[model samples]
Target: MDLQLQGKVAIVTGASKGIGFYTALQLVKEGAHVTICARGEKYLEVAAASIKQQTGADVLAVPADVTKEQDCQAVIEKTIAHYGKLDILVNNAGTAAAHPFEQVATALWQTDLDVKLFGAIHCAKYAIPHMKQAGGGSIVNITAVLAKTPPASSLPTTVSRAAGLALTKAMSNDLGAYNIRVNAVCIGLIRSDQIEKCWQAQAPQLSWEEYSEQVGQSIPLGRIGSTEEAANVITFLVSDAASYVTGTTVNIDGGAGSAL
Candidate 1:
């Protein structure tokens, strides 16, 4: 049952909560030293503390906005400083705005690309060397189904995420020669903090549970997926179990995203 990940070093950007938090927890459980990052210093610290307290695993908490190149490089440097090497990189930091495409302003569109697309580029640029030093590693970019499904409201998110998928494949094509496997997972709706924020702001009249169910029913699976569910597939893609998997996107949408 060992993933052969013991002692491996990983960086999970936007790990303050949600899927990143669960992904980091799962990696630590499998014995990987994880570095978590987010923009909010206080919340990032708290997330690190909570994960450490629960798992008794080594961790580095860095407050860095993924959109900033300097912040992205700082995460890689700090991870190497603590763990001496990087074996896995999870580019998970991103934001989604549920606005119609017709209404999306130029500024909003620019912001989406800045965070989702460019952020992945910056992190991978720095992490590749450390990964190359390790003789090869895995890079998992956490994308969303909107990339394929094309959500009606979240136009910017759909476009940005689709761009991320392209980045994943392109990175895989280039990094393959170096033995660094790069892949992306097109995530479906899950119980993440960002979704919670969106729901509360949009549907203030509905209780959290009501709002969750309303969204869940729309998914083909009849419920929203758990972060752990999404992380397991991601974990497999990064682990030795998926050694041959690269330049591919595994969609975990509960059949909601029947993308042609």
Candidate 2:
């Protein structure tokens, strides 16, 4: 079970809560020095404190909007300044803006793309050279199952995720020469704060249990995924355990995206 992550350095975006939060804590569990980022400086500080308290691990919380170039660069620069090297880059800063296909406005499309697609792209752009200088590194893009499944009700998220998948592949192919492995994990119905936000706005009538059940029932596993479960996959991909893995998107959906 040695993930070989001890003493390594990692960057996890949107770590204020949800999957990014879990992923950061998980890395700390494996003994990696983690730097987490999000737009809200307030939430980010609270999350950083929680991670440190929970794991007794050192954490640096950088308040940076991954969607912007300056912020992305600051994340990289700050990591190197603090940790001296960056071992893993988890592009987990994304949002859910799915609506009926016809109702998705052009502005909404642009907003989603700016945060999800360009955010990953910008992070990768800065990290590649650093990885080259450091001799190698791993980049894990946090996409979702919708990339392949393309839920009818979720259009923009799916389209943008599809682009993320492409980004993962192309980056992997191009960066493999530098010993940088780029891969993505397609998240399923993981219980997280994002779901809470959506539920509050979309299905507030359903109690959490009922809401979870409604979603989990569709999974062959008979349950929705956990933050730790998703983090395990991400950690594996970024760890030496998955050294040969790259140019791929591993679906973490509980048979939700099962191929015939």
Candidate 3:
């Protein structure tokens, strides 16, 4: 199953750990030169080093907060400067923060929108032009299943992710003529560093493995997803294999999402 991604250039946001890290690694595995960005410089560098060691592919670690427009622009600029082209942009920088609607503050909503919605916008804005110049490219937004199947206490994240899904469709429509494919992956209960942190903070007695197992039992697939599982789909979306896939949202959620 060659994805035909060899020699392509890609930039993945929030790549220090979790799904983003695995996506970047998978891109490298498919022979793409990858630039991975995150807010923490130390972790980003370490991630890059680890990916390089594992795949023996070129990896660039760029420390940039995607919430800032300038940082998003810098990510594209640096990738182009080094790789001379941009073929894939993975807008994967975000976190799931939920609060009761009545308890949600304006600041909280703004913060969520900044990272999930505007973060994708800024990265796509910068990447689109280069992609057009290079003839074509792919953009994969990492959203959540809650965007389609909203649940209680998922205030700001739900709203912002729904907006991200809309962005994926809009970008796909507008950029289709330029051969740039825009798509999104809506996640459910996936194993990641953020989830681990939450479990540690909320239930100190339960190890992540135990916590994940408990949650997985409720899902239709009888297990939670892995970072590699999500990454595999993303790599395909960004590759020549998914040449006709655009303006679509794929649910990577072990049948967790209620909406089709």
Candidate 4:
């Protein structure tokens, strides 16, 4: 399918690696221009270069910490200065902050909210106007299945993601008149840099496939998801192909989540 995304402009946050990186790459492959942002300037630039090499498309690398409102604004401003408009925003910047409630300090909770929740808000606040000017656009929030089914020791991330779900719905209702759509994706255990770190520390003796197989045994689908799998749905959600999808979430959990 064409996706009708050629020449569209997009921004993907936390794109130095993992899902964010793959999503940005996929967008460029589909003929869309992408701006990828992250806190680490070095890695962010590397990611941009890799995307450009792979897709033969131009990609902007913005080193911004999404937790800061000013940085979020700068990202949008720079994007507009370069691309002239915005059509898609993927609020994918975040970190894993799950811990026992008693172990999580107040400071930790605040930081988690700042990055996962307010980060999305800040980006959306700046991106929405440009989207409205464009006459239509799509926004996809990257959340976790724990938002819908919180397990033990899932602290700030669960609460923050639940808030994200509410934000998605509310934004959708408000932006519908402007032809803007808002949605989210609830991710499950997926192969990512974070998971790679864990695997190296916890089970380095095993081959990568062996470790992944062991992890997959716990999931209903008998495997963990890949970054490309998650990115494919996100690309579609932000494309003209999913024009009617809004105020909703698609679970990419491989049947691991209990929520409908």
Candidate 5:
């Protein structure tokens, strides 16, 4: 299906690897000019090159820590300078910092909020004006199902993600008049760098497929989701194909979470 994204300009944060990388690649595949940013310059450039090679599209690599307001502004400014205008923004930079409430330190909580919550806010704060100026645009926040169905010991990640869901709704209401759509996707058990790290740390003897199968037993889908699966939803949400979608959350959890 045509996403109607050709010639659109987009920014996907934390695109160095994992879900963010695949989201940027998918946007490029849909014919959007994408600017991908991450804290690591080396990995960000590599991701950009890969997208260019795959889609033959112009990809911009920006090195920025979304936790920093200045860095977020820089990303928006650079994208505008390079692309002339903005059409989509995917606030995908985040860290999975979950721990028992009693064991979680104040500093860890602050750091988690800084990266996951404020990061999205900063990016959206900067992107909204440009989106308004360009007449209309779409913003997709990459959240987690834990936001709605918090499990035991899922501390700051769930809290921050819940805040993101709220942000998505609030922004959609405020920006609807400008034709800027705001929405979010709640991810669950997706194959990503963090999930791979868990496999390496907990069950090194098991092959990746074996580890994923064991992990997926509890999920209704009977398997872990791929990055592409997550990205496909995100690309659609940010495209004209979903022109009327806003102020909502799509759960990409394979029936793993209880929340609707």
Candidate 6:
């Protein structure tokens, strides 16, 4: 099951922790050189060090806010400067808080779009050229199940993810001629730092195992997903094994999303 990913250069955003960190780590495991970025410098450095220690792969940690155009540009610039070519771009930056439409503030909506939608746009805008120059590349946007099935009280996240899905499709069509492939992975309830924080803040009495079981009951698979599970799919999408896969949104939910 060779992914044919040796020496491929990749950039993964929001890789300081959680799914992003796992994705970058798995890419390195599959023999890819990865540049991981996040807004938090401390966590980014620590993550890079851990990945290097664990995988013995070339890992560069860049601290940049995805919401800013300059930051996104810097990420691409530094990646090329370090690796000399780009093969994969995983736009996994922002997370939007859930709220009802009436309760959603204008500021909140704008900020969500800035981090999720515009963040991908800025990264792709710069990465596309390098991808084209390299003759081809893969781009994976880490969206959510809410993009296709919007539950009540899910405001900006659903809207933002829908935009991301659309972007994935549109980019696939536009870049196919250049041999560039674009796709997305729609997430569900996966264990992560953010999810753990929310659980702790809301249910201080529940241990992680207890809370996870309670949450998994609602999903058809009877358990939440793992970071490695999501990362495996992403790594595949970026590999030669998935050379024919593009413009598709694959749901990594544990059968939680209603739509196909």
Best-fitting candidate, scored by lDDT: 4
- Candidate RMSDs in Å, in order, are 2.3, 2.2, 1.8, 1.0, 1.3, 1.6
lDDT of 2 by residue, 126-235 (tens): 88888899899999999988788676789789899889999999988899998999999998889887677877887799987777777788898777788889998999
C-alpha lDDT (0 to 100) for residue 122 of candidate 5: 95
Sort the predicted structures by TM-score, highest score first: 4, 5, 6, 3, 2, 1
* Better candidate by lDDT, 2 or 4: 4
Q: lDDT score of model 3? A: 0.91
- C-alpha lDDT values of all predictions: 0.88, 0.89, 0.91, 0.95, 0.93, 0.93
lDDT of 2: 0.89
Sum up the clashes in candidate 2: 0
Better of 1 and 2 by lDDT: 2
List TM-scores for all candidates, in order. 0.92, 0.93, 0.95, 0.97, 0.96, 0.95
Q: For model 2, where is the 10-residue window of minimal lDDT?
A: 251-260
Clashes (backbone N, CA, C under 3 Å), per candidate, total 0, 0, 0, 0, 0, 0
Residue 121 Cα positional deviation in candidate 3, in Å, after optimal superposition: 0.4
lDDT of 6 by residue, 1-260 (tens): 99999999999999989899999999999989999999999999999989989987669889999999999999999999999999999999987688989999999999999999999999999999999999999999999998898989999999999999999999999999999999999999898887888888988798877787788998998877889999999999989999999999999999988998
**Candidate 5 lDDT tens digits, 1-260:** 88999999999999999889999999888788999999999998889889888888769999999989999999999999999999999999998788989989999989999999899999999998999899999999999999998889999889999999999999999999999999999999899877898999999999988998899999998889999999999999999999999999999988999888
| Candidate 3 per-residue C-alpha lDDT over 1-260 given as tens digits, one digit per residue, 9 for 90 to 100 | 88999999999999999999999999988889999999999998899889878877669888999899999999999999998999999999997789889999999999999999999999989999999999999999999999997889999999999999999998899999999999999988888777777778877797767777777887898777889999999999999999999999999999978887
Q: Model 4, 45-144: lDDT tens per residue? A: 8998898788787799999999999999999999999999999999999999988889999999999999999999999999999999999999999999
Note the residue pairs that clash in candidate 2: none
Q: Is candidate 1 or candidate 4 better by TM-score?
A: 4
Residue 196, model 4: Cα distance from true site in angstroms: 1.5
Could you tell me the TM-score of candidate 1? Answer: 0.92
Q: What global local distance difference test value does model 4 have?
A: 0.95
Best by TM-score: 4
Return the lDDT, model 4, position 156: 80
